[model samples]
Target: MTAAAIGASFRPNELEVRPDGSGNLLGSLCRSCGAHFFPIREACAGCLSEDLKTVRFATEGTLYTYTIVRQSTPAFEVPYALGYVDLPEGVRIMGQITGVEFSDISIGMPMVLVLEPFGTSEAGDALTGYRFRPADVTSD
Candidate 1:
């Protein structure tokens, strides 16, 4: 299968699933200015660097801020937590917070990245996406 074929049904970025069926999301790291971007970028926003290397991000981060989305959107489910995560590599990402109740969410909480089904593309293929879950639940 082609890269588009596999990534078509999943997230915006190409994902690699290990033999254990664990997902590892891929992103681009700017080789020139050391900037990292999720969903990948053709050029670095900091230095306008065109040389980017693909990298797999660590599946852990710290919650920066969040909001309990009570209203449903076309692409997201209602009562979900959406927030920015401060990755260890110094890049901040906006994503959903899963595996926890909305009442339990707070700033500076520990989180782990996980792949989830977001919605669909324009062509109607299921679009898998990434989210951050409370680290406490996966700490065992």
Candidate 2:
């Protein structure tokens, strides 16, 4: 696979699109306390550790809580599932849900992060981004 095959990351700092079409959500890990923070925190919230390192989070997680948003802002459409997933690294992340029927989504289900084209840049270039789907689901 090549970088051209998968497109570029929507937000390079938050989402990293690997050449193989798979990607990981980017976060910061506290070197001192092992605490992980999403969106790359400047300091560890749990232990107040300033020595943080960038890390790619595990793609798999467990759905902790969710909401089916029937309405949203212009950038997002309605009838989307928004959820909080608990990663094994001890971080809770919020992302859009995909690849499952609205009624089929449930708390505690196994989830896996996926990368897809999110939108276009000002130059009209494709921007790859991350979302979550049921672990058992197949992609088209």
Candidate 3:
């Protein structure tokens, strides 16, 4: 890692990147209803319970669906693949698809989270962010 990368930190909300390059998505787990939510809610929507705890979601998920995005805001580049990945904890996460050709992505392929430099801070510091990538595996 470069010196800038070593000093990078994730933006508050969905990501929690560690210094060791091992991190997970931030979410809320409801102790009452056993439900998980992304973006860390203070209360559980499932059971309307306030007994929620902040938790880190799993890094791996299965691509539930995808699309080729030809239009987006200026901050993002065009013609990117976007998808909703189904995590093991029952939360569906939306991220920019990466590490594979658009034609190769499928509805059920295994995916893993990977952190990259998303942008820079106002003070010109690197900001870490995440995206989903193709899982390492071989076909039978």
Given candidate 3, what's the lDDT at residue 98?
Answer: 80
Regarding TM-score, does 1 or 2 come out ahead? 2
Sorted by lDDT, highest first, which candidate order results?
2, 3, 1
RMSD each, Å: 4.5, 1.5, 3.0
- Show the lowest summed lDDT stretch of 10 residues, model 1: 1-10
The C-alpha TM-scores of every prediction are 0.76, 0.92, 0.90
- For residues 21-64, what per-residue lDDT tens digits would candidate 2 score against the true structure? 88889899999988888989898888988899999999999999
Q: Report how far residue 108 has shifted in candidate 1, in Å.
A: 0.3
Candidate-wise lDDT, in order: 0.76, 0.90, 0.85
TM-score winner among the candidates? 2
Candidate of highest lDDT: 2
**Distance from true location, Cα of 10 in model 3, Å:** 4.1
Candidate 3 or 2, higher TM-score: 2
- For model 2, the superposed segments whose C-alpha errors exceed 4 Å read 1-3
Can you write out model 1's per-residue Cα lDDT over 1-140, one digit (the tens) per residue?
33343333254365654433356667889999898887678999989989999898888889999998889867555777889998887778888888987888899999998765556778877555567899988622
Pairs of colliding residues, candidate 3: none
TM-score of 3: 0.90
